[model samples]
Target: MTEKSMLVVSAHSADFVWRAGGAIALHKKNGYRVKVVCLSFGERGESAKLWRKGPDMTIEKVKAARREEALAAAENLGAECEFFDLGDYPLRVSDEALLRLVDVYRDVQPAFVLSHSQKDPYNFDHPLAMHVAQEARIIAQAEGHNPGQKIVGAPPVYAFEPHQTEQCEWIPNTFLDITEVWDVKRRAIECMAGQEHLWEYYTRVAQQRGVQAKRNIGITVKRDIQYAEGYMRLTPAVVGDLS
Candidate 1:
């Protein structure tokens, strides 16, 4: 039997760590192969703390630091990470880069794809990443893209939680109970020292989502959910039964 895998397309190095760390860790524990593709190191935009370290902080240095942090985080979550180093703060994806992502789609043939919300007013890069991820998946499904290559199936695409869901118009229709893997996710979050300010914020987000998840399931379920990650599934799920 082929190994099941999941893909995560991140706008920046720390995006997957912050938004989908719990999902990654939980899936990894469940024996799924996790692959993370970071479009950029977020050196210019997301690495503000590094940039504030005087004039000695160069772009190369910042990129290296971000890459190291992302690597550590991925390791903690048992994921394999690939960096595009495409640059950020106005991330531009060339046709070549898009095709490269399509190759990943074909190779991994992920069971599901995780990315940013379709609309994020605060950060244009976030939405663009999701756009690219969806586009690549479509291309990978087209047999003409690469004649003999195996075509990927229609894997469900999910938008992980955004920083500000209200402004982004992102609603969580799926909640993953990540209580068992929360510790692994927390360790991964700590690996992102460059964005220390958001550590506690995401923790609270998990806690809030956990409460919401518990409420949604009603009182009949005996499972106690203490930590959760929310996702907005962008694709249709075929089911045999509604309940």
Candidate 2:
């Protein structure tokens, strides 16, 4: 319900959809822009879903389809998307990679930066993304550290919940209300025909979180609400009570 650009970095292309699409859509509808940076196209990460399409699809073709699906999904959510094309599975964040990512942080300088939680179920890009983003936070703030970095003044940064709750350490202090934009979120997710199965998969996750939020606040967050996204402010975001 606020107006400010947000940058989301994910370990894979479809991640922004399954985990954070609702928030992305809500952000855009509220006059907040968004940019998603995927560390990989998920080439080696997992392709059984994509391969189920047919036996003839090549690796390149699957990757291309994923990018197409992601771009379409992002647009539907009112956000733009980009992929670093880093090989998935065993993504390594080189010192140079850290510098490069910081470059993007500098260029976008989004009011809020989002990325994977440091904890994840798998042993791959999720942790790499978390580490890279964490380093970027510091590198972006490091004066004269890399004059070549493309972003601008540092913005508020946040960490998002991962796909597997138990695998990653996700300590979310902020729960965004996507009830108003839930439909738009659903529509955006549908764009990922490649991940239709995930719809049913994540719906439950959303419901669980919604119930948790309501219990914590002692208010019922309607059942029509099927999805939500969570985050923890890396920097304090104080409204009215600036004390």
Model 1, clash count?
Answer: 0
lDDT of 2 at 170: 70
lDDT for model 2, please.
0.74
For model 1, the local distance difference test gives: 0.96
State the displacement of the C-alpha of residue 148, model 1, in Å, after optimal TM-score superposition: 0.5
Clashing pairs in 2: 106-150, 106-151, 106-152, 107-150, 107-151, 119-168, 119-169, 120-168
- How well is each residue in 1-243 modelled by candidate 2, as lDDT tens digits? 634677888888888887788888887887887888888878666556778767787889888988888888888888878788877777766677667777777766678778777767665677678778777877787778756545455576677777665656677787766777777777777877776777876767766766666665655544444345677667766678854
Candidate whose TM-score is highest: 1
TM-score of each: 0.99, 0.85
Highest lDDT scorer: 1
